[model samples]
Target chain A: MRAGLDIDMPPSNDPFYAGLGQAVRIGTELLAALIVGGGLGWAADTYLFASGPWGMVVGLIVGVTAGIRNVMRAAQNWSK
Target chain B: MEESPLHPFELHNYIPINLFGLDISINKAVIMMWVVVGLAAFLLVKAGRSRRMVPTKLQSLGELLVEFIRDIILDTMGKGGLKFFPFIATLFVFILFSNLLGLIPGTYTVTSQIIVTAVFALTVYAISIVMGFILHGVKFLGILVPPGTPGWLLPLMIPIELVSQLARPISLAVRLFANMTAGHTILGVLFGLAIGGGLLIGWLPFAFTIAMNGLEVGIAFIQAYIFTVLTCVYIGDAFHLHGADDHAH
Candidate 1:
């Protein structure tokens, strides 16, 4: 009810706050995307190489890539 | 697939012994809470004693913490809320210290324990309820009655609001406890896997361990913020200042 105005502002040009906002935004999106990517990758790996380590490999690769993309997006939006 | 690793309910790794016939259980969780209490007390006192026009590093740290809690109170309760600063600041400092203590190796991470979290949550509930009734008397019951409800719906709205209100403490405790416990458990399991799965499978789990550790660090701070913020929200409801809407009218 108080709204967002009550929250404290970070020091101007503070790298810590900038990084934190970037991390929070990016991390949330990345986690969701990873769930989707991991599921897809797991399904593909199951069919291609049944019960293989490649499933984890593929999932990790895609999840990391998507996570990085989210980080970049957050940086663009949150930067002062 | 895998075993539960550890039960959240069971007091595993906890040992009990008799101390002055008190039968104290020396668990990791209890120790961590003591550490949190000690650290908060130490830092705040040290900071208070060392105050200066040009602040020392410890004093500056204390000021920053005070400002953080002050903002939360001001934003939620407004200027009139300043009186509650001691309570709010203490809660924030205790939670933050407890959470950060969990990050230390071999520390019990008391917030990971449900009892500690429950106690803190109940404290907030007690404060808000007591304050509400004391300040507003019978009008405090009106908290459940929103401003514009039809008279017919008063019976229905009141009970639902009461249930929801009661659940606030449970949810607050669960949110902090679950997040901290789950995060720490995940880190534990990942590293356990790295150690158990041989060096061949080491890199993958190791990477996860590091990333999750970093995430846990963020979560440590976040859970503290969230717990404190919700306390402010509850406090706002208690006083029913104009900006606090859910309890309005």
Candidate 2:
């Protein structure tokens, strides 16, 4: 029981748990940024402007960039 | 005989209640929530009742949980965060318990539902936003702009930061919901194959189901941990605007 308890002890120091936590977080951060940016772009195209395909195109690009930026920030935290 | 992998996720109301046209129904998820709250309260209260220099098992577990959550608050929010111990502790315990408890064969996973996770995420995000406004007033808007940015880039940078900021709650909700849903779906598919395969090839997928269940347990713990850490980080950012970018070399 003690050994089992030690597995989760100070997750920041435990390689396996920390590594797993970091991985899931980074994956979601990238995806979420993309979803937000793209969704906003789509909404703008549909509601605000009658732009055809252009709005979505710009939104996707921004989404990808934001996703990468999020991934970088998450990585920086991991390295620290 | 074919069954959808998502079949288990469907909810059936036990006692349907409509109040002011809102469907507030008693279902598996709702019952599970009550069970989780009751069990957690019982365990923690029982643990607290014991006063001994030599701690009992339950007492030690309670202490470890407290110290773990305390360390998280201290690391992210600093000494001032001790005020939020109760909030953080409740979030940790509730999430951790639900995630672990949902793994049982007959129990429903409350966190697997997008609505449940979304509500929790929105509440946390709203609290951070309100706290920032109350503490820093109008200056809380400065969070949209990073610490080191020239005037020329402000136009482009602000929109990008704005999108990322809006994505916070969305990411938090989607992450937990997707993980739990996907994990269970895979388990369901594997178990279905195991059952349908009969005595010959059934053992293989059955074995994988067991392995995946083990992995899911680890996922459960990691998800709860990440949720707590991010919650702390978000609130901490409200406490100190532009603090995260201070040491950028």
Highest lDDT among the candidates is held by which one? 2
Which sections of candidate 1 miss by over 4 Å? A1-80, B1-4, B7-23, B241-249
Model 1, span B1-249: residue lDDT tens: 365655533465468887799867877666667878987898789999985887777777777777777776776677878988888888878877887887776676777777788999899989989999999998888776767889998765554444445556766787678777788788878877887888788879989999988767766776787677668878787888233733211
Q: Give the TM-score of each candidate.
A: 0.70, 0.94
- Model 2 chain B lDDT-worst window of ten: B240-249
Which docking category, incorrect, acceptable, medium or high, applies to candidate 2? acceptable
Candidates, DockQ: 0.03, 0.47
What would the per-residue lDDT of candidate 2 be over residues B112-142, giving only the tens digit for each residue?
A: 9999889889988998899899999999999
Please list the residue runs of candidate 2 whose C-alpha ends up more than 4 Å from where it truly belongs after superposition.
A1-10, B245-249
lDDT string, candidate 1, A1-80, tens digits: 12223333242234574455344434444554455456656876777768676776666566555545544533553343
Candidate 2 lDDT (Cα, whole model)?
0.84
Clashing pairs in 1: none
TM-score of chain B of each: 0.88, 0.96
